[model samples]
Each structure stands twice: as C-alpha cells, then as structure tokens.
Target chain A: MKRTDVTARLLPKLVKASASAEQFAPSNIALCKYWGKRDAELNLPINASLSVSLDYLGTHTRLIPIEGQVDEVWLNGQQLQPGARFSRKVSAFIDLFRRDQTLCFKVETRNNIPTAAGLASSASGFAALTLALNDALALDLPPEALSILARMGSGSACRSLFEGFVEWRMGQREDGLDSHGIPLDASWPGFCIGLVEVDAAEKAVDSRSGMQRTVETAHLYQSWPLQAAADMSKLQQAIQERDFSLLGQTAEQNALSMHATMIASWPPLLYWQPDSVAAMQKVWQLRAQGLELYFTMDAGPNLKLLFQRQDRDVVLQHFPNLETVEPFGSE
Target chain B: MKRTDVTARLLPKLVKASASAEQFAPSNIALCKYWGKRDAELNLPINASLSVSLDYLGTHTRLIPIEGQVDEVWLNGQQLQPGARFSRKVSAFIDLFRRDQTLCFKVETRNNIPTAAGLASSASGFAALTLALNDALALDLPPEALSILARMGSGSACRSLFEGFVEWRMGQREDGLDSHGIPLDASWPGFCIGLVEVDAAEKAVDSRSGMQRTVETAHLYQSWPLQAAADMSKLQQAIQERDFSLLGQTAEQNALSMHATMIASWPPLLYWQPDSVAAMQKVWQLRAQGLELYFTMDAGPNLKLLFQRQDRDVVLQHFPNLETVEPFGSE
Candidate 1:
C-alpha cells in the first residue's frame, strides 16, 4: 500500500470542519498491576488487572481539529517539542480517529497527577484525550470502544474509561476484540487512597519499556499472569463481599507480585525508595494498632495507601506529611 | 532434653589450653543468590547456590585462648560492644567449640570489605573467624565441618571457606549437617570481578530478616528454589566447561532470580538505587557493544561486574570512578 493509502482506506474522505470538545478523565491505581504486554503493537496485556479510579488526580484534555496536516500537542501549559516521544504518541493516538483524513489536531492536556511517577497519568491523559477526540469527531462510540482506543496510547489507560473498581480483562483472542474495561462497582463506600510521594523525580525506566524488558528477560515474569488471573477473581469476590481486609491484602500482594517481575528483569528494576519502605512499615504498625489500611505502588517510589473513608482522619493523621486523594463522591 | 542439659551434653569435657592460630577467608558473590531458608535457626538455605570468592575483599582473623570467662572480641581496631547482636552471634558461634564451658578466648578481626553494604562481609568475617577458632583450639575440624559452623553464623558464609568457584548445596537434612560449600575449582584463569559501589551504606533490610519475610509472604518464593537448583547444576557445568558466555549469562540470571523473591516480600526490599540503575544500563550498553561481562549484586546497592582478567583495563575504563577488584592470582 502507498503512504496515504491506509489512511484513505481507514478514514473518511471529506468531512465538514468539526468543533472542539473537552472531557475530564480521572487517574487510576492498579490494585493488580499490569506488568507486561503480549503484543506491543496493539498494547495487549499479558494478564488481567483491577484498579480504582481516583476522584481528583486526572488529565483535562481539550481537542480541536485544524486544517493543518500534522497534530499539535501541548501538555501542562507548555507545548511539547515536535518529534518528542510523548508528542509522537499523542499524534499516533489521534491518527486512529481519522474520520477526516486531513483534520490535524490541537491537543492541550493538563494532568493533576505527576507524569511517569506510576500514578497511571498516561491512562487518564489518553482516556480524556480519546474521549474528547471521539466526541469532537461525532463518533459517539460507546465507553468500551473509547477504552479500547485509549489502550493503544498506554495499556493501562483502558481502565480509566470506567469509574470505581474497574477490571481490564485480557481477552482470549489473537486480535484482542473482547478486551476492555468492565466496571465492577460504581462506588465502593468507605474506600480512600493516600498518595505518599517517596520521590518526585522521573523514574529511570518508563513503565512501558520496563515491563517489556521484564517480559523479555525476567524468568519470574513467566509465572505471573496465572497468579494475576487468580487475583482478579479473588479481588472481585472481595469487592462483592465488602471484605476490606481480604481485598486490601490481595491488592497489596498483587502489586508486589507485579513488581516481582520487574525486579527479576535482566539488570533488575527496583522502584521502592527508603521512604517507601518506611511508609509500608508504618502501615503495618498501624494495622497492628487496629487501623485498616494497605499500600500499593506501581513502577515508582510513591505509595498509594488504601483505607476506609470513615477512617480518613486517623489515616491522614498517620501521614501528616503525605498528600491524600479521596474517591469520587466520598465525604 | 532440657536446654541447659542439651548444651552440657553437646560440649566436651575440660581440656588443656591450646595454641592460637590465624586464618584468612575471602568473601563470595553468589552467582545464584540464596534468598530463603529451610531452617532459620540452623541457617539452612531453601536452595543450592554457586559463588565466586574474591581475592582482595576478605577478613583476616587471629584467635588466642585465654583465662577470662567471657570472650574478648575486637574488630577493625575497635572492641565491639559485648551484648550487641553481632557480638552475641560471634559468641554463640564460638560456643560450639566449648571443650570447657567456662573457657574464654580473645578474637581479633579485620575486614577489607565494608560490613553490611552487600559485599558478604559477614560471610568472610565469620568464615575466617570459624577457621581461626578451629585452628587455635587444635580442634582440627575439616573444611566441610568448618563450613557447617560458618553456616551457623551466616547462611551464605559457608561459601566463603573455599577459594575460587564454590557451591553451597542446600542439603535435604533437617539437622543441616550436610549443608556446606563444595569447592568447584582452585582457580579459573582470566575470570575477574569489577566492584561498583552504587551506595556504600548498610542495607535497610539485612538478608536474614529480608529472606525470612520473603519466605513467609512472597508467593513467588515458593517457585524459586526449584529454579535455583536447576541454575546450580547449569552454573557448575558452565564452570566445568569454562564457557565464559554461558557462565556469565547464568550467573547474571541467577542473581536476578534471587532478588525476585525480595521484590515480592510483604513490604518489598529493593536493593538498587538510581546510580545502581545507571551502572546496570552501562553494563547492558557495553554488552550490546560486545563486552564479555555481566553483573550480580547481593542484598545491597553494589554490583559485581564479572569479566575476564585480560579485559580488566577495558572494564576499569568503563567505571573509572568505581573501585575495582581483581582475581587473587591475576596478572
């Protein structure tokens, strides 16, 4: 096929100019981390993962179609340099929705969560970006379709289309037709997330490349998908039963299991810092002293603590220095 | 039997004082890391591991029998506090040689390696100490017996008794009588080690407690011992065949597999720092450019670069600021 042939075949010929649209998509933390991909091109995960969407931390994306030939991207009040990795990814994502093959995009995104610090900022960013693009182009695709497209930008971004407890099921197909986020709950009462920043600096390894390396080299990575699948069901059952203790314990273990693959990667990737250790120790101590809380971290030194919203005062008291994030519609 | 009665039965009757003796023991780096224990009290490993002893980094110890009721211990020119945890461990280790329960001795030690920065300082220290104690008291214990005693002090310490390639076989006995280091080679020509100090501080989690937690909580730990056993045989074959590439690849993978258990620990014990990641990246880059070297780390933030002695200058060139360690009889 010629250079523009695929675009012509996939995209519409001549469409009227479409107006701009904006959408707010909240960030998410995977209770069961997605560590590796089966197919990198399609962004298919090796295992299923469950996550809780944050009420506050998110990406607000504004999308506009222009007559120009190339997509323009600006993030966090600064225009991304042309040919940058992120700019290229954003451009590629918009390229997917080429209803008007000539419609270039102007994308301005602002994220409340720190980028690449393991808060799944890319998830929220792509989710909102995909949502706004779909709306702006009058595609009116369902949320599941939006999630599948958002996943092309970043694998875990699939979970951000749904609120509360969401599971990204790794579909049983070569083409990944069935894979998408399933909302397990609209809301889980008394659930809260505490963000403990162990280090604010950018990670040495990005989650994508890190997980790819793990999948390629780590021997332990071979055994993780089976356990992760088991954890998905276990976590779902705990959610249905409202078993906080079981849910928290399984979530914590699943996160650690995901990290175990990274740690066994050739050259190894260690994400926890000294303060990350201290915070976990404090959580254990608090649990011993009759508090209900557990912690999970994803590819960064920061720890996201899970607890009951009713115990917010006590939980926040223990982490006086930490920034806290509550679930949507929580007191 | 009662504790005191068993102690009395284990100890020999009073004998005449014996002459003092000195011994030098080298530290070892596990190619296949030992992460868990079958018996905590006996220091029996969950898996067999292969290691290479370093030439320069070791502990030199001298022992002398004395009339005092309590053992006198001095380390690196300073007397360790009597009731400190290390002092107590050393004392208990010496008690195994108690021909006279009231017999006391003076022990002096010096280590070229840092104590707890994952250089296996305790391995070398206790290995030398036990060797010297066995010599001084004229107990004439065989090297295997000495290794067993060394294992009592620190699990991996047993590997330090032998020169060159060593294997600490995780024996199947509960009494741990057969768990000892088997010397694989007196020397292997051209094999060299380059020490890169990522962080020269004591680890937040020591290997013993760290492995204890890993064994208790990490689900992956259950699967590691089997892999470790297979690696042990593969490493021994690589050593026997003198296949540098195969040996290096297996050693590197073994170290990472050991670390995999720690990453799945309840709180997770991460031993790498940012610079550690940098060093590892450099190693991978060097390898892609065709350098014959691999990295293996213990329980701390240092990496041991395995290479050929002829490539010492080239390896040292890559890490000018980092300290390097040469083989015992390298040119």
Candidate 2:
C-alpha cells in the first residue's frame, strides 16, 4: 500500500488516543564514551555510555494512526519517500515493533532542541519515537527494554530511555540482547545541567558516519574500551559524590578523546569548528578567573554546563554574550 | 666594530674550527605545546621534550670571517637583514649569548626543514648553531648545560641535545634556570622510527606565534598540565616495561591531546594537513588488524611510526601504496 493510504488509515486512531498526548525531546550528552561501532547494523556500541535525558531540551512528538492501512510515517508534515534518508531506519523501526499492525504515523515533532547540531538529535528523535509509539500502541514494555530496541535505531538513544543519571551497560553477551539502559535512580532531580546554546549549526558528519569512521580507521579505538572503563568508573563516582569538577573534567576529556578518535580515523575529519573551540575557551577563561563554571560539549558548538543551581548566575554571566537556553522551565 | 668587520674575524675562527670538527645537523620537532618564554629575551619552553633530531635533515651552515666590529649572522649568506622572518626570540638569543664575546662571525645558513611548517626550524637551526659554535669557539660547555642554554633558545631544542629518548621536565622554579634535559637512559639503542616527510612548501607559522595564539585563545591549553602529568607517568611506565602497546597507546593519545588543545585553541588554526591525517589513518587501519605498529606526529605531515625492527617488513608491506622514506642510513 502507498504511504499516504497507510497514513490516512493510521491518523484517526493516533488522534483519538493522544488528543493531547505530547512527545518529549531531549538533548544528548555523551557520557563515558561511544567512539566506535561494534554492530553498525544494530547501531550498537563497542563501549556503552551513561547519559541523562534532558527533559527540557528535546523534541515533543505525537503519532496519530489513520483509519485504513496507513501508508507511511510523516515527520513535521513532510512525507519522506521510500528511498529517503530516514526511510530505511524508520521503516525498520516500525517493521520491528509493529510488524503485524498496519498503521501510518503522523509524527508531529516540535524540536525545542537543534537537529544535527551534535547534541544527539537522533537520540531525542528515537527516544521520542519509542515513547510516542509505546503510548500510541498501548504496549506496556518497560523503558529499559524500549531503550534496547531503540539502540537498534541509534546507540545513544538507549541512554535517553532513562531519567536523571543512567548507564548503558556494555554487556558482554554475544547476541547483544542484554545490553540495555539502566537508571542510576529514577528519583534524583537535583542533578541540574544548563545548556549554553552558542550556535545551532549542523555538523559535516552525522554521528552514524562519524562512528563508522572511528571503527574503520581509528587505531586508537582499540584502546577506547580500557579508557572508557576508567572514565565510566570516574563518571559514576563523580555523579555519586556530586562532584561537578570531576564530571566537567571527565566529559571534556571524553569529548576530546572522541574527537581524537575521529582525527585518527581514516580520511580524518574534525567535528569541531572554530566557534566550538571558542565557546570552550570562553568557558575555561571564565572558570580560571575563579568562576566555577565547567562546560561540556557533545559534538557541536553548544555547550552543557553542569553546575549547582545556586551558581547559575555566576555561570550564566560567563556566557552573557551568548544567547542562553534554559534546560528546565521557570529557571 | 661593524658587522662586516666582525664577520671577517669570526668567519676565520669558524673556518678553522670546521676544518677540524665533524659536521653535525639535527632536524627539529615543534613541541606543539609552547609554554611561556623561559627568558622572553631567549625563547624557551617551560618544560622539556624528546625530539628526534633528523641527522640528514637540517640547515647548511658556513661561517666565514668578514670585516666587522660586531658579530653578524646572515641566513643563506644574506646580510643580517632586517625584517626577515625568523623566531622573534632570535634577536634576544644572539644578543645575550654574544654579550660576553668579542668574536665577530659572518654565519650563513640554508635550511631544508620547512620554515613555519609549524615545525621548529629555529629549534633545529639554533641547536645546530649551538653545536657548530661550540666547535668554532671551543667554549666546551657540557652537553647537559648546552642543552639548558639551547632550551633558553627554544624549548624543544633541548631535545636535540640527546640522540634517543628525551624527557622535558617542567621545572618548579619560574626563572627557568633549573630547566634542563636528561637522557632517558645511557644505553638504550635507537628504536626504529619510520618517517614520512612531506614538503609543506609554504612559509608556515612559527611556534612562537602559534603558541601565542594558543595562550591567548586556547582554553584547552589550560587542560594540558594535567594531561602532561598523566602522560609523563604513563610514558615512564611504558618505557620501563618496554611495552609497545602502552607506549603506542599513550604516545598516540598524547599527540592527539596536543592537537585537540590546538583545535580548542582560539582563532583556531590547524597545523595538520590532509595528508597528515591520511598517514595517521593508514597506521590506524594497519594497527586495527592486529599490527603492533604505532605512530606519532609532530607539527608537519611526516609521521614517525614506531614499528618493531623484526616486524618492520611486515608492517611496511601493508602500505605498499604509501611512499616511504627511510632514515639516512637505512638500506
């Protein structure tokens, strides 16, 4: 059946269930490391990372099914053709989860977060898809399991499956069935992080191609497993002790390590821009002058500054020239 | 006491000494991490480094006596002309080193090292001058103390004081008088390091400017002290164990960290060429397939791959496509 027909059929059902069902978008922060791909087909990581779902800075998506055999999925009202960039992955996602059901999805996605800005748009998109689909289908699977399925879509997506601090354990299981997201705790809300949106420009290479490059040519990727282990341990301890210093220091180095792997990767490309470096330098300079501001960058110029709420103004003043985006509502 | 008359007297001394001394030339490696001026008068590093002084690669120098009252130095037989691009620190080095001497010299030098290739030609040139001048003047400073003085000229030049492994210590005192070089060991044989030299063919930015850019803009430079400390410890362990895996792993990461700091440096400029990354990738690909081959790069396109002497052929066979240049005497 044509995608239009499928969407025509699925839209009615989606609207009835989610008259106001909103999708949530979250920006991604690379935790320990996710430099190489072990299974590109599955989008699995050689080493797992722990990340928090940024509830305030992500896309909110809602899916509505039409009456008849819904023909396709439409994102932001744009019908992607069969051979389109997102088609294979979206089709595979739908086919894997709703194989017996013929439903078209109207993915009304409002992205509060930037797309392809290296803040893990894929993570937010996939996690929102997982959440929206689960709500639409009424399939009551745990968030942990949903993330494992989402990992098949994008590796970092698994981390957004949890709230607060989370870890995607790099299970040694050969089938990769056991690798899934686990929350450090569903109850911790004091873990506050600020997003300093410097620039929201798209990157030259997306995460998929970037990871593939690292796996294919980064000789240093071989050492990532050991380093990730060390970093992960440090990250866990930092989170537990609420050590923002260690957290900021570790994240910056991990990001540097990831970029290092990229440079060492074949046909080496730099994911960083002059602005991105400038953003980081500005943060460092402010911090050096005794301002306790620690900044972490994902894959782009925008930075995630993790600090205590009391110090928000102190940190916020550092980026006074930059247009700031608050992570949570009302401060 | 004009420069010409000074050269007339000094050149004869240089000629007399050259006739009896064995000519030596050492290639320079830019530390990439340029610290503050040890003596703003004499450009120097806050720390020491291990540099591979390329024997066959260096400046051609002929010191000839000319009619002069004061000593004069010329590059490529040109009169010590004004506004010729060299390390700005050059002026201070000449003035201070010759402060006590009346020996006038007409020194001419032709360099093969790419000027401003972000590679330290000044380090090599001055180091070679240090050796050549010692031969000419018979000052007879010990190699260690000579290295200290050369370091006062350029940080990495001290690395040229020794043949094999070198460690540049970031001394505690700020005066930099204590800043000196120490050999890794007395008898460690020369490890096989393969070089791939690319002619940058353009006047590259000198290390001083590059470092000043780093100091002014690179917030990432703030992180280098910690990284250097970690690297120094790990490197010592690796050298002690003779563990190629650890050595390669640490060196590769250190080089990348150094580059990352550069990338993060503001007004960001890259010292790397496309070919530099390509060479890096080739090594990575070969290493991924279980080749114990390891690589490190200085400022230019040339990569120094530390391959086992026994497995050198095996490693070289993998990259039949890449143009490989053997070190001076390698058959």
**Docking quality (DockQ) for each candidate:** 0.23, 0.07
Candidate 2 residues B109-196, lDDT tens each? 6677543333456666666666666665555667766666676666677766665456766565544545666667722233455656
lDDT of 2 at A165: 70
lDDT of 1 by residue, B167-256 (tens): 888888767777899988546777887777766434367778888888886777766876677677778788878888888888887777
Model 1 chain A scores worst on lDDT over the 10 consecutive residues at: A1-10
lDDT of 2 by residue, A216-306 (tens): 6555555556656767988888878777777767766666656655664545555555455456656656766876566566655466666
A103-184 in candidate 1: lDDT tens per residue?
7878999998853345767899989998887778877677777777777778888899878889999887655656778888
Q: On a 0 to 100 scale, what is the lDDT of residue A122 in model 2?
A: 74
User: What docking class should model 2 receive?
Assistant: incorrect
